[model samples]
Target: MEEESGLSDVLPRDLASLFSDTYTEESHYQFCGQQLRITQLYGARLGVAAPVWDAALNLCSFFEEQKLNFKGKKIIELGAGTGIVGILLSLLGGDVTLTDLPHTLPQIEKNVSANILAGCPPNVCALSWGFDQVNFPQDYDFVIGADIVYLKETYDLLLCTLQHLCGPSTTMFLSSKMRAEHGTVDFFQHVLPKHFNVDLQWRNVEDNINIYKVTQFQN
Candidate 1:
């Protein structure tokens, strides 16, 4: 995707549309203790018309702490809504693949390009996810998603997607406000241990979020 030309192209207007009323271009959120560029795009209008909420950004503090040399390692991000997290990984040097349902691909592409306004880096495009086949790189080093679990029916497909990408060395990181919804904790408990070694790092009840590290192998 091409880098979007202007800052006006990426800014958000409404508070409710942004998931949290607090994040703005001037907001300083310290994650992992680094002052990093962060964008919150949930419900931020994107696309040919307006954007939909299917993804969000990575806290660069936490992201920078992650030692992924994107130089050649294969990385695939599931449910990449705004595509921020995946793009950041790509920017850091990974051979990145961004995947989301077909409906969200366009905005994902748009934001990918928009974020690259600072610079256009090369990376793979969007793909529709499937459970039956592990179609991309078989030896994936990392797989990640943010705020993806909120439904029961999607549990089967989400697990299928994660399993297809895991190969004994893959690491998975999922972040979420873990907002009140159907089957929230059940989804985490059922799928977390079965697919990857789960680590509950921290929880910010005030922010309604949690941090987890699920890896393919203990390091």
Candidate 2:
């Protein structure tokens, strides 16, 4: 798995400190036979959307390991923090869109701009879960998310957004760091299965991350 030092171990003790002025950080990874330099903007008060998380790295690894073909696929990544997963997919020839909360777009856009290919540039957009999902089309070939199922408050909203984004044949791959306190497992085990057929695709035992392959349940 891709590893980064510093900030991952030491986070600010003060809650207010997390909302301070934004600083920049960079992470490097190998994907699709190319070294990717991903620029991450931190301390901008963009919770969960600033840095590249472990789950995101693991998801990228999962995609490469599975040898999934992304060429010509229309993909959308939800809660696309740092836009790493979508960017990697875009590199693999997928027509990708990276989406997150409005405030999160700048960092995502920066990363997308920094790593633009000649003709495979990924689009960045603001997607506020349930509220703005209607603006996006529902026929994406693949819906991808990493570490997005933590908040209990937004469970329903996230589900609603997933429903709006997925068409009949759309497949979803969601990677999550299984933090018990955050109710991640409950959302995957109980809530998600109701609307989608969920299957465990991969698991990183050491990091407690799991990747699930999901598709809409047919009646």
Candidate 3:
């Protein structure tokens, strides 16, 4: 994970493909120009949060490119499975809140506790999509989600959750690998625009991942 002679730690597009693989147990990554070490505590369950995936890595790289000094900016990561993105942002200076289902909290908290030693450690909370009132703070400068739009039934709920968390100016970063055959991408496209203005920020052709930057278009 050597920097190829640049200020940013982002790997070149050609070299990023080398990292695409299913992480089984403990693994280390050079994320956003820093060493990100992660491990899987439990077995790989069907619905449970697992280890790092390609979309997560792409989101990390996208954050680096944005160059928004995260320090003191309140951020929220929806469906924060491994909490990798939120943890990395916290390390970089963001005050992050990592939210997921109740069952997913243990693993996410474990990752957050292990990785975030200084600065603002991310707050791990249990959150279900489409709640009228969430337990955690609602206002955030940015909301991030990675590989979260995979399920067919949860599309609207995901949008609702984002709507609830975001302020009028909150910018959201969502990364997902296309699953057109499963209607994942189409459903997301249909629902997302109703809430925010969606723009394709970057695409990783090698990994088939799309990172989108979303901003609220209405009050």
Of the two candidates 2 and 3, the one with more favorable TM-score, higher being better, is 2
Candidate 1, 1-108: lDDT as tens digits: 111222133334443344333332312233333232434333323221122222233333356656535567677777666566676666666677777655556656
Window of ten residues with lowest summed lDDT in model 3 = 1-10
Could you tell which candidate, 1 or 2, scores higher by lDDT?
A: 2
lDDT of 1 at 89: 68
CA displacement after TM-score superposition, residue 201 of candidate 3 (Å): 0.2
Worst 10 residues of 1 by lDDT: 1-10
Per-residue lDDT for 53-148 in model 3, tens only?
A: 688889988888877677888998887878888889888888888887777777788788778777568888777787633655667898888888
Q: Model 2: per-residue lDDT, tens digit, 1-219?
A: 111122333334564355366878788999658578898776646654677888999999998888999999999999897989999899889999998877778888888888875886998888887898999998899999998876667778889999898899899999998867667899899888888899999999999999999998887
RMSD of 3: 8.8
**C-alpha RMSD of each candidate structure in angstroms:** 7.8, 4.6, 8.8
Candidate that would win on lDDT: 2
Model 1 pairs whose backbones collide: 4-113, 45-51, 46-51, 54-81, 55-81, 70-93, 70-94, 71-93
How many clashes in each structure?
8, 0, 1
